[model samples]
Target: MFLQITGYMTLIGLTLYLGLRPVSGRYFVDMATYYNYFQNYSLGAHVTSSKDVVFHYFMKFSSHFMTAHGFFLLMDIIYIYPLYLFSKKYFKQYWYYSFLVLIVSFSFYSYGTNGIRNGAATSLFVLGLCFPENKIKTGICFITAALFHKSLTLPIGAYLLTLMYNNPKTYLIAWLAAIPVSLVAGSVFVSLFSSLGFDDRLAGYLTGQGNLDVPVYTGFRWDFIFYSSFAVFAGWYFIIKKGFHDTFYFKILNIYLICNAFWILVIRAPFSNRFAYLSWFLMGIVIMYPILKQPLFKNHQLFISKIITVYFLFTFLMYFVYYN
Candidate 1:
């Protein structure tokens, strides 16, 4: 798995270096400015009033673009390695789990290279997963994440839910009831943002109200939905077969899916792609534990796994090729 991960990293690095000029050429002036802001924030310059200030402080002290990327890259390493350890705690031959981590890391690295809050927030979220049993520690981690990006506050509730429930049916019913309430609140929040004179840049970005067209690869792709559905079914089957009554992870997955689904209904715009990222991230974990434990899938699983892997890789590569 290490070798496989290394190979993927090498290919990605080589692709970026070779394609840098073309990639940069394709980005619009505003997008380019954001990239410069990311690189510049690493040099102590304030870019925005948003919560990225916390990350800005760390990046500024680093004092170089390579240093900043290197820091986050190291954090990514730290965040993902523990996932392997966690999987190994349950399944001894945990090497295969590394592929799951690589898929997530590479996909995020590809789309989120704009160096905003998304990449940093994702790394912190993964790290929070490692400390699931420690609420105080996990809460601190998420609070730091909220400082970098407010969107992260969504999953912090899931961590708390783990402490609240032990039964699957009860948890599912509660979550279903809560979804409508959250949606109403989110709608009210949007109205508040409007009343507060929220910057047009952020509003445009969040609501997809800008001039940018919906890229082909944007939104919930059919292939992704297909694969995620299969993973959900497979995971459900594995848990039932193993007599694993724990509902925490399942509840988390349900929240992620429901949140994304609601965003699709309310937003009705291209930025729905952002919510799709949450879906993929949660589904990756949902798929991982089952694939590790089910002997029935051990032989035929690679066939299906490779398809999803290649689909994401191709989607990300094309996103860069077209949208840069």
Candidate 2:
């Protein structure tokens, strides 16, 4: 009990410290965008997203009571709270591993620092996963998340499709189809988005007209493919070899597969990588859970844990030092 309390408190302290400090260097685009939005709201500039309008006005109203840092602090709390809840409930058997998973998920930090709304949205999505038995509640959470960030449509939409045909073969077919889809995804995306009356910024992204300062999408990212290949194999091993097909880990693996399919198909589309984060963020858990459960590593869990911690910490520190 004391150990659990200490761990939770440490989580809170770390979140507070990181959330308060603004990200620096090349990753400053989204922060700059937020500041621009704040200024625009202050000047009564017309914005397209009513959700953004509400968020902007809320921040404006909040300014009367707190500084900009306070707003970020609140958002940061909202973002992490659901994640903490999900880890506690689902990963209760391996609580420390849950903590390590959160610590190692760099994408979570990227979303939190770059697009806070998406961070909060993904966190809510995590809660939806936690309550999988409650379909209505889960649906409501997913819709609410979409209201915050439309980019969620890719992952959420594909996940819905998975609900229809959940066989591994279906996912495999989708993955195979991605190569052909890559040829036309960019054009089709632009046309469809334009017809749907998407916002200028998003439309520009699809049409390749805007410079949103996001990473340029080169086709067939080797790094993503490498990680994705491992995820696919790990997922298959857990489901087929270990008989964990009906488990939550299997569900996450499937989601990762779907996300990977979309990524492979539309590799050149701007901000397409965001779709993968829906599943990629859960990679730590999917990989760790099965390995930790295996009898071969039971005796060396602590040693393995320490090594994992050191590697992730080194990567995290290097990211901040070099990228920031």
Candidate 3:
């Protein structure tokens, strides 16, 4: 009882710390961009988002009554509160454990700081999926999520398609096929995808034409391919080996597989993590949700203790050692 209360307390403090961070490009780069946008809107500069209209309008509306810091705090809430709600709904008593997994995810902090719109939208996507029975509520959440970040359409569309013809093996096959295709086709895939014009930024990523002020790497990113394979491997072990045929779990696995495969096809693109993140955002949930939901081991608590340690250790090593 006391532990759960403390967990919530810690969550509140963490949220506030992230929300109140200073606006600086050296550190939360997108926060500075957003601050600029907010200032423009506040000064009647007529800001708009052709696709992310809700986001621009929200900025426009918020500019009237809030300081940029407060707006950032609100964005943090939008990015984080949904995770709290979903963890509570799904994990119940052990809600904090699942919430902790989400917060500690490799992509979570970066998204919140660097890709604020995607962060908040994906969190809402997580919350919206919590309501499987309420179609209207789910639809609204998905639509609103897309309006905030159009890239959300990839996962949202994948999820909806999975709902219709969800065969895990089929997605797994597609995911594997993408690897060889990407290896052989190489830059050919990039040019083809860039021509689609889904989003201009996406085009830039595909074509290595990103607008940047710092050196960026572009190549066959085996490190990321291995990282993404974690989900594919874990899902197969749990579902195919251990028989976690939970339809919802299969859907999540399928969603991750589909999106991850699309990312693999564009593995050599600049800032491709932006594409990989569509699935990486689901990694912790993919790996942790099943373990939390089922008593797969005799001493499930002990198992979870070890899993959490290893999980966070990997995140720590990756961020500090590899990334730094």
Candidate 4:
């Protein structure tokens, strides 16, 4: 009991420290975007889109009693809650290990700093995933998440796809379909969304006209596919061979596959990294839970834990190194 309290306190304290730190050097542009938006919001600038309007007003409301940093700090803190709830409910005995996974994934600090809105929404999506049986609540969380950041709509769609198709073939199909989708349907895809009233700013971002790094349909990126493919195969192992097909584990694996598929399909879209996080945020669980379930790795689990710890320690260090 004492240990648990200490553990949670340590986690919370560390998260708070990271959250309160100034924006890292690497995310200067992302920070600028948020700062600009917040400033505009405070000045009552007209936010054109529903999503931007919503975020703007929320920030405006928050800035009344607190500084902008305070709002960011709050988002950073709130982001961890869903992760905590996930561990408490699903991981149970292995919750500590799960938390370690999350830390190493850089999901918290990276997203907290670079994509505050998405980070907060992803946290809620994770909490919603904790209740796979509660479809209505999960749907609410998913939709709410997308409203916060448009990229999340893909994950929500992916989740819906998982519900319809539970077979292995869908995974293969998603991967294969990405090639044609990105190559041929790229412009059509953008046009379709534009027709559906995707915000002009978002469209600009998608086309790399809004200071975004990558343009839509910028041809295939082997690097993303290489790394992401590993996650897809890992999901396959857990879902099929590990016999988690009917469990929440399968649900996570399914979500990962579908999100990865979307990421692959739109590998060149501006802000495409969002799709990666949609799945990667939950990857700690998809990877950790199965290994914990296996008996042979029980003793070595301690070694595995240490390795994961070291990896994240390296990650934390790299955040400063790369950013600096």
What's the TM-score of each model vs. the native?
Answer: 0.65, 0.79, 0.96, 0.80
lDDT (10s digit) by residue, model 3, range 144-257: 999998889999999999879998988888999999999999678778888986688778777767674335778889989888888898898888888877888888889999
Better of 1 and 2 by lDDT: 2
Indicate which candidate wins on TM-score: 3
**TM-score of model 4 (CA atoms):** 0.80
Error of 1 at 162 (Å): 4.4
What's the true lDDT of residue 40 in model 1?
Answer: 74
lDDT of 1 by residue, 1-324 (tens): 764566447545643442242225154232354445557766567646554567556555545546534544444443344445444445465544544443453344443444335555755765566566687766677788766665565565554554565444443344344445544464554445445554564455455675443453333344444444544454455556655544555655554545444443333334545545555555556655545544444455575467458646655665566346
- Residue 156 of model 1: what lDDT? 58
lDDT scores for all predictions?
0.51, 0.65, 0.85, 0.68
* Per-residue error (Å), model 4, residue 287: 1.5
In what order do the candidates fall by TM-score, top score first? 3, 4, 2, 1
Candidate 2 segments exceeding 4 Å error = 1-6, 22-27, 39-54, 57-64, 176-198, 289-324
Pairs of residues clashing in candidate 1: none
Q: Of 2 and 4, which scores higher on lDDT?
A: 4
lDDT of 2 at 55: 53
Q: RMSD to the native, candidate 1?
A: 5.9
Tell how far residue 133 is off in model 1, in angstroms. 3.0
